[model samples]
Target chain A: MAELVFLKLGGSLITDKRRQETARREVITRSAQEIAAALAATPGLRLLVGHGSGSFGHFAAHRYHVRQGNLEDWRGYAETAAAAQRLNRLVTDALLAAGVPAISVQPSASAEAHDGVLQTMAVTPIRTLLDRGVVPLIYGDVALDDVRGCTIISTEQIMALLVAALRPRRIIMAGEVEGVYTADPQRTPTAERIPAIGPHNYAQVEALLTTAFGVDVTGGMLDKVRTLYGLVTQHRGLSARIISGRPPGAIERALRDPSAPLGTLISGDGAAASPAVGGR
Target chain B: MAELVFLKLGGSLITDKRRQETARREVITRSAQEIAAALAATPGLRLLVGHGSGSFGHFAAHRYHVRQGNLEDWRGYAETAAAAQRLNRLVTDALLAAGVPAISVQPSASAEAHDGVLQTMAVTPIRTLLDRGVVPLIYGDVALDDVRGCTIISTEQIMALLVAALRPRRIIMAGEVEGVYTADPQRTPTAERIPAIGPHNYAQVEALLTTAFGVDVTGGMLDKVRTLYGLVTQHRGLSARIISGRPPGAIERALRDPSAPLGTLISGDGAAASPAVGGR
Candidate 1:
């Protein structure tokens, strides 16, 4: 009914991509509870959530060598995407069991692959589901590959694509850490957590981050942010955030404020400009 | 291991295609029991089983208008194929419960749609399963099609392709009827069951027969015979039958018999052979 908040649930926090443990159960359970609470806390705001495949997918994709190099194996990509679909179903089932009316619209079932890039994207079908108030969930996928074959379309790409197409007001990416840290907290003792990032310093922030360089095996964080930056700058579209998903109600606060406590924010103005401050 | 015998279990007899009801439970259950009994009775043979999507699939593909023509709407095909995949899982579960060690290898997961007409048949991944004495079960699939858009590679095509490539010893197609009949016995007062049909005359017989009718949705008796004929005519391959799959022990007899009863046997030599008369 109401406009939606495109919530991207990062794989790192939910599934522990590093250890290949589907550890997001407690977090997801709490998040779902928080989401329902958020719906109650706020008024008349619809939500469409997309979750990454966590370790079940990322670790498997890497172990199976889906993204071994720049060159890709189309079939392997498709298979890796299939693995993600399987995880999507698993997640959908979990959500449904918790009374979240979720559906999985796999990317492979939608996008027509043209070599390595998407040639045509059919979003009309998905829009109908979203319009009907059903939370349509999507994830990173092994997409139709024309050349080296199946390309891994990250959830970040999906988010960017959806934003570019829908021009939503804002996007929220839920991760394990509190926003984008100037450094990896686990490794560096004083890796300062950057409160906010703008289009102006996107390249700088990206330099600090060489891909999603944490637990993600599907690729690195760099691809995710790069994809988001590409979407925002190229399309001059909506704002997005990379928030820490581990917090009890981080997504809810992020949805309410331009500044959420968790993860970094990447606004359309390139990571530069007058950044939206976190209210926390 | 003994040469492989590829078995195709048609869906028409076991359930109502549209509603996906296990209407043929009496027959299939008995068929399963008998098949197990026969396997215990008979020795020195290995089998690779492929079950059709049955009513579960044909209804979706046709009802959804997927088969009307080829289009770029792979999404539609994806829906249809997903329907078939559901049925495949259900049937695989059923067979496993029936004591047949079958593993469902979804066609969409394994098949590649090239410039149409199945360029290369790859059972490469499932070879180890087959080698381990596990029945590698494949089914009709709405595979990711390359040309005619989303293509329906039917169970018939799967059999044809595998037989052509694997060059199996014999192929048995088990369905509802008591072999090929002169006409629809239910509709015709004097419909006679044809015990056997000569290779070249099978089509001619089908044109003149009355009992070749009925809920013969899968192109009736003639279509089955024609496919069976085409498949076995090579390797000077083993004989094939179109039998009443409902009768208890019929499939087993058909599978284990030096000669099996209950169906018309199509031989490469154009002889009107009986599975019971001369086991191929």
Candidate 2:
């Protein structure tokens, strides 16, 4: 089997969450270049890219109350789905321009959630493309639900499901912040970064991490940690690293070597000791 | 089971094929209105709309040589797929504006082809949406092929596959011309229009029909007839009608009455007599 990696580009990294439908073009282009460099360094590496909806999807979904399901009018569903696709297009285009063969795969078309939990996902098409050395790009979107009629599915949720099916070597979560911190680093001067986490220390770290501030329909850092925690605990061999994409070489480093002292690492064994008071 | 119809809006009808990437917005809006009116006239009607790639897809697919497959460069695949999605967005937007509740279900994300033959398609999501009374809008797109690497799959091919799964009440092919004529209507004034075609008279009528003119990556009229002929013949109960979308009430009439004397009908049994052409 080829070495596969699942990477999530947090919406905050690629788009301006403060403004509706505002894409951070320069940041996205730089990130794509970094990803391309990583692929060049690692031979036979297959990647599955998923990005958060950011402002593009969240604003429209919120305006229409799309996540509530069973709306008096179904037009909101169409609008929400379109907005997500628009963002996916922008992300895929940047990757393509940066020499990555990124193909857009909308989740709503092939995924279903029953009461906010993904029940069935057709991943064969994605698998075939990945085997052929093509990058399959996915994103958060509105999906049909058996119990709720229709609901919003987050990128992290979709990635967790994909990790189970594809069994990627490692998952790299890239965002604006360096990693999970003891508290909101921006607000608290005494806060410190947590370098490593596992089932043993997950609850302790979870209590310290703060939810991201902005217009995010999907729960921010807390939801991401919760989803990754479940996957890492269940799949002993799998681990996920959370890193800041803003730095020059953070993404490549996290992808190339997960245990590097650059960012926080979450695993099943909890073998690595926490590095203290790292300078940002 | 509610009544379902598989309606295909030919790219030539909704777009200016002579000009690359130019969508005929006016025509699309008019067609949507006709479809909406029909849905209002008949209660409990469900629809699955599939449109051709038109200028948007054909131009990129041709430029990239995507259909030939096994190309040295893979970037063409991403380009081609992006082009198709652009057109699908425009179409879905028009349907939503007309209050049709159209949702885009991208074929490339959940569909695979083996040597240009569709191997697997995750149609369950679409089925669920249709069950909830939402129109699942699909389009011709670039698909990964096991044998050829990647190939372009036409809207008719996708719709034919859906017919087997959904077993819609009828299939309507809306295009620029009124119907399949005995000869090139523009060149041959004496040519007559064939009202009905079946297994018995298909070969004779097929030889007389002319292929559509333009830059269509997928073969035009001849290809449509061959696909529908195979489908209608084997299914026995299934029938497809070719009609002009330009005329007022033509699409609504065709959807409501497949055997109506408006266009060419391909059926298992030859019931309607072939109508001779008097004038256009």
Best by TM-score: 2
lDDT tens digits, residue span A1-280, model 1: 3546888887876676656545567777776666656666656566667887777667646755654322323233433544565566556556555555454555554454455565555565456445545566777775544453345667766766677666676678888767666666787788787666665677788777764455453235566677766666665546667777786777668766654445666666543345344412
In model 2, the fraction of reference contacts reproduced equals: 0.74
Tens digit per residue, CA lDDT, model 2, A162-249 = 8878888778899988887776788778768877787667877766553433325324677777778788888767778888999888
Off by over 4 Å in 2: A210-219, A256-260, A271-280, B63-65, B210-219, B256-260, B270-280
CA shift of B237, model 2, Å? 3.8
The runs of at least 3 residues in candidate 1 whose Cα sits more than 4 Å from the true structure, single-residue gaps closed, are: A1-280, B18-44, B70-75, B110-117, B200-206, B209-218, B270-280
TM-score of each candidate? 0.56, 0.89
For candidate 1, lDDT tens digit of each residue in B116-220?
455444554345445545566777776544454445677777777767656777677887676665666766778776666666566677566534454444265
CAPRI-style docking class of model 1 based on DockQ: incorrect
**Against the true two-chain complex, what DockQ does each candidate achieve?**
0.06, 0.68
Count of steric clashes across candidates, in order = 40, 0
Clashes of 1: 40
Task: Please give the TM-score that candidate 1 achieves against the real structure.
Answer: 0.56
Report the poorest 10 consecutive residues by lDDT, candidate 1 chain A: A69-78
